[model samples]
Target: MDETLREQQLRMTRFIRDPHANLPPPGIEARRLAVYRQLFLGNVQGLLAGSFPVLRATLANDLWQSLVEDFYACHRCRTPLFTEVAGEWVGYLESREDLPGWVAELAHYEWIETVLLLSDSTDPAHEPEGDLFNGVPLLSSLAMPLAYVWPVSQIGPGHVPQKAPGEPTLLLARRGADQKVYFSRLAPLAYALLVSLREQQISGREHLETLAELAGMEWDVLEPQATALLLDLKAQGVVLGTYSG
Candidate 1:
């Protein structure tokens, strides 16, 4: 590209991204610039609104618009894909200190749906009906165990928490075989077990024994309860049975 043309393109992009702080390119008419600015900002806002419906509905209209506008102006997104815009928006919210403490957490909680829906990865090779305790347990590639300080799942227009609760919230987000995403609350032990499964490729029995030690209980006593929990996870599609490979 020519040096002058490159500069002109940069100016136009800067103005479109943040009209208040930037001047339009020299040849563009103010009427045309306004159209371009609104078009770009509207596209960004629409993507974010769809991705974070709960957050969008919880905040006042003006505040939400302002927040989106600020993100458009200030954030330098790493990706050009529109589908990934929500993730970028979450990163922007996480970086900001001016917004409410729960804003980033809520945005992230909402963004997980988009991530799982668009993910291309498939579950690893494993026996769907294999024994979970004897073989290495297989956690579905699409299943994610998340811990948030705020009750992100319960937050909405009707329920805005003033302060975070004493205990962190443990939630499971998974993409089912039907191509639908689901969210559910998780008990602390359940969360720990899932996290361990995700982080370490170990047998279910070993995982349970470790958990029993952590909880200060004998393996014989915890085995029944842990086995039941594992069975339930398998039924829910969160646990894809024991690892076969």
Candidate 2:
């Protein structure tokens, strides 16, 4: 006999799920129900396709359109503010254990540029005080250190052809002194160090030691590569500040 709140909520959710579903909930106008549906779907599609331009070009439009719809319908975004929908898209792939291995990796690669551009940091992340070779600081915000199980950025025009690359590519994306964006491929060890430092919450210098320890690599070999990685991270504006005492 009672109109349950749970039932009402589900009814409202259906309106969002099916754009054309006609429901006259007070704030929403019945006559223009389809407009809101189309508008919401359109904006999301643009961002998704824009981030994965190469992938969008590769897939049939219908398939691509369906992908965006699935993401919209299922994803409960962490950030409601949405300046970084692209980052959340990357997060979606990074967290999904069930995704096809190649598909998840490619999504991460395709979404990288969007993540960098929409990163709202006016200043770089904290950099630590240390010497290169003696020990080096690793990268953080203001710079985006990226790793993919596949080489997404390198597959431009025809380099990797239609399928995934045999090897992974390490990418460093950062804003320069002049505020221009740059991306460079990194060596596996350097990428491992940067990724460990950023995503794993390991400190820069310690992360290098981590790689060396894990691989039984001589710290001597890690020293120069880690040093180079830090310098490049700083020059690219990755270091926001020196880690303080």
Candidate 3:
């Protein structure tokens, strides 16, 4: 690109991104610049509104608009793709200090659905009906166990908690065979088990034994309950069955 033309493009982009702080490209009419500004911001806002409907609805209109505008103007996104804008917005929210503590958590909670829905990754080779205890248990590639300080699953316009609760929220977000994403609150034990499954390629029996030790319970005592939990998870599509490879 020619240096002069490159400079012109940069100036226009700055003006479109942050119109109030930037002067419109030298000879462009104010009306034309306004149109460009509105078009650009409107597109971004529409994309984000769809991505974070809960966050948008939870905040007051002015606050939401200001937040979006600040993100648009001040945050330089690493990706040029519109599909990744929500992730970028979440990253931006996590970096800000002035916002409420739950804001970033809620945004991340909302963004997870988008991430799972659009992910191109596929499940690894596994036996959907294999014995989970005898072979390595397979966790679904789309199943994610998340822990947050705020009750992000319950936060909304009418129910925003003034402070985080004593216990951190544990939740599982997974994609079903129908291609829809779902979120469920998880018990601490269940959360720990899932986290362990994700981190360790071990048989279900071994995983249960480890959990029993962690909980200070006998393996025989925990086996029945833990086995039931694994069965339920397999039924729910969270567990993809035993690892075949």
Taken over the whole model, the C-alpha lDDT of each candidate is 0.91, 0.64, 0.93
lDDT by residue (91-198, candidate 1, tens digit) is: 999988988889999999999998999999977788989888889989988999999999998899979999999999999999987989999999999999999999
> Where does the lowest 10-residue lDDT sum fall in candidate 3?
119-128
lDDT of model 3, residue 57: 94
Q: At residue 223, give the lDDT of candidate 1.
A: 90
Compared with the true structure, the alpha-carbon lDDT of candidate 1 equals: 0.91
Model 3 per-residue lDDT tens digits across residues 1-245: 89999999999999999988987899999999889999999999999999999999998999989989999999989999999999999999999899999999999999999999998898888899999988999998999999999999899979999989999999999988789999999998899999999999988888989999999999888888899999999999899889887
Point out where model 3 deviates above 4 Å: none
Output the lDDT of residue 120, model 2: 67
Off by over 4 Å in 2: 1-13, 19-32, 91-100, 121-140, 156-166, 196-213, 217-242
Q: What is the TM-score of each candidate against the true structure?
A: 0.94, 0.66, 0.94
**C-alpha RMSD values across all candidates:** 1.5, 5.2, 1.5
Task: Name the best candidate (by lDDT).
Answer: 3
Worst 10 residues of 2 by lDDT: 126-135
Better of 1 and 2 by TM-score: 1
Ranking by TM-score: 3, 1, 2
In angstroms, give how far residue 219 of model 2 lies from its true place. 5.0
Q: Would you give me the overall lDDT of model 3?
A: 0.93
Task: Give residue 13's error in model 2 in angstroms.
Answer: 5.7
